[model samples]
Target: MAAGPGRYSKRVRRQQDILQILAQEPTMRVKALAARLEVTTETIRRDLEELAEQGLISRTYGGAMLRAEAEPALSQRERELVKEREAIARSAFRQCAHGKTFMIGSGATTAILAKRLAFELRNVTVIAHSFAVAMALAQNPTIRIIMAPGIYHAGEGAMHGAQTIRFLQDYAADWAILGASALSPDGPSDALFEAADVYGTMLRQASHNMIVADHSKFDRMATARYAQWSEIETLVSDRRPEGPLMRALERREVQFILAEG
Candidate 1:
C-alpha cells in the first residue's frame, strides 16, 4: 500500500532528528543515521544533501562534519560587543599621549581604540598583529603603522606563529594595549594557547601593560592565562569591578579604570 501525507511528515521529523544527532556528533555516517532513525540509507543521503545545501553542515567522504568556520565572524562579534568595546577603547585612549609608540593586540576592543587613535592622536606609531587594526589606522599619514607577519587566524583576526614571536622580540614600545577573553582575580586569560603566547610577548616588549575588556569577561576562566594581576599596570573596563573582584584587585594594588559610555 502507498504511504499517506502523515508518513511524509514522519520522514521530515526523522530528518530533523538526524540533524540534531549529527550536530552533537558531526562524524556520523549515513548508514548510522539510517539505522538510528529506522529509515533507508537513501533517505539519509537525501537529508544530508539538503543540509549541505543550506550550509548547515558539511559532507565528508563517508560521513558529515561541522564546518569549523561556521561560527559568527569578527564583524558579528563586534556588533554584539559594541557598547562594552567602545567603553574599553575610550578608557585605553585616555592613557595615550602624543608621539608615543604603542603595541596593540588583535581584538574588537583594540580595533575600536585604533580607529579612535587614528583620528585623535598625532604623530603616534602603532605596532599591531591585527589586519583590521592596521587597516583602520592606515589612512593616517601621521601615524606609523607596523604589521607583524605570521599565520593569520581569521577568527581572532590576528597573525600568530613563530615568525610573529621573533619579530616582536626586537621591538619595544612605551605601552602595550591588549584584550582578553576572560578576567579573574588572578588576571587575564585567553581561549587559545597561541593567543596567550602572543599577549605574553606583547606584555614583555612594553614598558607598561594595559588590558581592555568588558564586564562580561570578569570572573571567567579560559584555556590559558596570559598574565597575572601584578603584570597588568592598568585595566580598562566598561563597568566597575564589584565584590570579590574589586577587593582582589585592591589587595593586589592593580590600577583599574571604569569607562563611562
Candidate 2:
C-alpha cells in the first residue's frame, strides 16, 4: 500500500522532532525515544544513524550520545598549584604602584595577578594581551583595561601578531609583569617565536620589567629566549634559589622577591 503525501510529510517532521529532542538530551535509548515519539524501534534507529552521520551524535549499542566539547579546563592545574599561584600574585601586586600604567603578559600566574590588581589597585591603566586578564579586569571601573589586538591563542588566552607589536609601540608603561615558560641564569625562555617577539616588545615599552614565576620554572629552558638576565629588574617567584644560581643572579644585580607560602 502506498503512503499518502501527508503521511510521508508527517513522518519526516517526526524524524526532525526526534533529532531535536535527542540533541537536547543526548543519551536516550532507542526504545525510550520510540516511546516518546510514538514510533517503532526501527524508526528511531534510522533517525540516530542520520544524525550520527551529520557529526552531531554517536550511535551506541542501545543509545545515542552527544559529541564532547573541545576546550581544556584549568581546574586540574589550578587545584594542584593554587598555593604557589596565590603567593606569586601577592608578591607581584606589591611591585605595582597606585595610578601607574602597567602591562601584564599572559600566563596562569599573571592572570591571577590581573584579578588581584583590579580589586586592590585604584585608578590604574592596564594593558594586556591576555583575554583572561582583560576579562578579569573588565569589571573594575577604576582600572582602565586596554587589550592588544592580534590573533587569539586559546591555550594562553592572549592575542599575538604584528598588529599587537605595533599597538604596543605607541605607549610605554611604568612597569610590565611578565610570565616565562622557563627561566635560567641566562634569561627568560619561551616556546613560540611569535610569543618571544611580543614579550620583547612589551619589555622595550616598559620602564621596569618584573617576572612572575613559580618554583618549577627556575633553571628550565625552552626553545627561545625572550629576555636576558640583565633586562629583568625584579624576579617575583614562589621559590628562591640557593647555591650557585642564587649567586649568579646577585652578581647580575637581579632582585629576587620570594613570595610567602
Candidate 3:
C-alpha cells in the first residue's frame, strides 16, 4: 500500500509523514523535519533521499519539494495502495443502494468499488466509461452495466470526449461515485484534463456525489479542479484528513468517512 495504517513499518510511516508535510508546505528542510518529527537530522536526510529516489519528491539542497508527477496509467496505479484502496472500496460499498443506478468514474479506487458492488449489490445499474469498471461489474449477472461511448484513452483505460458527455446527458443516476487525483482545501481535482470533464458530467448527472480517494491525495494539487466542495456530498478515504483540508470539508458540510484498514 502507498500509505497504509500505523501497522506499516516505522520507516514507511515516517516517509509518508514527510510527504504529508511537504504537501501542506512548498518545501521543508531536513533540519525542520527532524525537529518536527523528533528524529535526528541524519534520519530525516535518509528518508528524503529515499523519497527522492522513488521520484515522489525532489531533493533541493538540504530540503525536499513535492514532485508533480504526471498521472500514472491505470495499471500502474492499481498496483499501488492496494490495501488502502480496498478498505476504502469496501467502506464505500455501504453507500451503494440496492436496485439503484450509479454513475461511476474511472480510477483504481472506483474500479475496486465496482468489483465489490458486483458481488454485494443486486439488480443495480452502473453507467461508466471505464473499461475496468465495466468489466468488473459485468461479473454479476444481476447488475446491468452501461458503457458510455466516446474516444478511448489508453492511459486511463476509459472513454472521454464530447460524445461521452453527450451520452451522459441522456441518463441520470442516484449516485455519482468518482475518484480524484488530489484533494486540497480548494476541492477535489483530477490530474488528467480529458477525464476531468467526464467526471464533472457524472456529478451533474447524479442526484448525489461521493469521492473515493486515499490519504496520499490529501493537500495535493492537480491539473483540473473538477468540482467544488459544496457539490460533493461525501468523501470516502483510508485515513482521516487533517489541518486545512479537514476544516474546509467541515465548513462545506461534506461528510468525511474514514475507511478502517
Which 10-residue span in candidate 1 carries the lowest summed lDDT?
64-73
- Selected candidate, larger TM-score, 1 vs 2: 1
- RMSD to the hidden true structure, all candidates: 10.9, 16.4, 9.3
User: Which residue pairs in model 3 clash with each other?
Assistant: none
Ranking by lDDT: 3, 1, 2
Best of the two (1, 3) by TM-score? 3
TM-score of 3: 0.77
Candidate 3: count of backbone clashes, pairs at least 3 residues apart or interchain: 0
Compared with the true structure, the alpha-carbon lDDT of candidate 1 equals 0.79
Model 2: CA > 4 A from native: 1-79
Q: Candidate 1, residues 1-261: lDDT per residue as tens digits?
A: 887999888867876787678556546778888898888889788888886776665666666644332224567768877887887787788886543888999878888989988889878888999988998898788999889989989887889988999999889999998988777565687877777888999999999889888876765555578998878888899888775557768888889998988
Prediction 2 global C-alpha lDDT = 0.77
Evaluation by lDDT, superior candidate among 1 and 3: 3
Query: Each candidate: what lDDT?
Result: 0.79, 0.77, 0.88
Please give the distance, in angstroms, between residue 53's alpha carbon in candidate 2 and its true position after superposition. 44
